[model samples]
Target: MRKVVKYLIVLVVFFMIPICILAHPGRLDANGCHTCRTNCAQYGLQDGQYHCHNGNSSSSSNSSSSNNSYNNVTTRKTTTTRKTTTTTKKQVYGCMDSSAINYNVDATNKDGSCQYEKTETKTEDINYDTKIKGNLKEGNKTVIEEGQKGQKEVTIKSVVDEDGNEISSEVVSEKIIKDPVDEVVEYEEEMSDSEALTILIIYVLNIILVMFYSKKNKNSKLIINYVRRIKIRIIKYIIYIIYFVYVIPVFIDVILVIIDFVKRKLKK
Candidate 1:
């Protein structure tokens, strides 16, 4: 009976050996190979060792070719998946117009938040100032120096639309191109008619006194000669006044009339 029991145990051990070899927990790859997970030394393999089954030459070649094909397919699938993921990435949106102040070069789409800048130049006239020199007669004007206008250049910066229409503007810089020249005026002073008449009356009274003194001292020869010289001087002054005030104007008018008549006769 012991021999019979020993024989049954031997048979069970022999069948269990093939079962353990085929029942490795590691999964097979495309090459029909698997890494050893347990009982490696028993199978003549190390831990984490890759091994394949023994087969015919033709089958082994076919399996290797299939394994290479499977690897190529898997590589192609991984490349396509990466390409798809990149294509599906989130898009960035920003201003796309180059003229915009906040333009974004790396943006994928326009967000309609573009801001533009425009500059304009303008010229302005500066008014000249006037300076009065002296007290002049009423309604009389004499210009001593002519006045000139100045020019100013203004640079304006503005925010505008795409059509170049201005939305808002600000003065950026101002420069004076030319300075203004001030005007200078002078006036003349003159005497009144009433003062001239008083002077004439005083001169007449002085002449009468000189005449009375000459008659009172008829035997005084020196006094009479001095009075006669004074009278002659007064007459010469009156003649000079008449020549300047009345005679010169009338002479000028007569000469102008004669010249005009001569010109008309020549034309005829």
Candidate 2:
């Protein structure tokens, strides 16, 4: 019991010294801060009896460091959410032969109807073999290229819609070609049977007229012989010669015409 009482007195004295020094800040002594047994504040020995000061090396400096650690973690969670966003850039290109011709198009909207389209196809594949090199300098700015080695995306979209309810039509095509175009040719020709028979009938009538010119005076009776004998037998010979040569072909042509007409009428 005596040892415990002695230990309790020592602890009481140690705690009371700090309270006394805080309440009444005295000058530093040669021995620095101390905790003595004499209660000098309650007596008349208060001038140099309770002189105590903090040592130069003490734990008071770390007491104020706790103020720097307060955070806004709760308010940050309520105000906003953290998420990762990805941004992308796209470019589209088209290509075709420059000398295209007669190309039909039926697009829905916003397109070239019948134009020859071409484009330059270029893509960047990083030349990693060249070796990009850099250095870190003091008191300087540094910027990082985000995605220098990644590939780019390209997209092209096309749509075609036609109205099925509209009536069918013959749309006249009119297109002006810029490049040298090939020549076009058109011909219209038709022959009918009536025109062909008119030609045949003219030749036949000419043949009948020539055949009736016998160039001799005939008897007035219905059937007469060669009565007026020829003083110009050569003329008569020429006349009859022309008649026989031309008349035979005409008779045969007339017979063919009659047969063709009969066949056509029977078919009808």
Which residue ranges in model 1 land beyond 4 Å of their true spot? 22-94, 105-113, 134-146, 168-175, 185-268
Q: List the global CA lDDT of all models.
A: 0.64, 0.41
lDDT of 2 by residue, 1-268 (tens): 9999999999999989966653433344454533323543342223333222332333222211111111110100112468999987443232222343323233223333233323222333432222222432222233233223433322322222222222222323323222222222222232236855786788777775664544332422212234225557776676556546757787787787767666656878
Best by TM-score: 1
Least accurate 10 contiguous residues by lDDT in model 1:
71-80
Task: Return the top candidate by lDDT.
Answer: 1
Q: Over the full model, what C-alpha lDDT does candidate 1 score relative to the true structure?
A: 0.64
Point out the worst 10-residue segment of candidate 2 by lDDT: 69-78
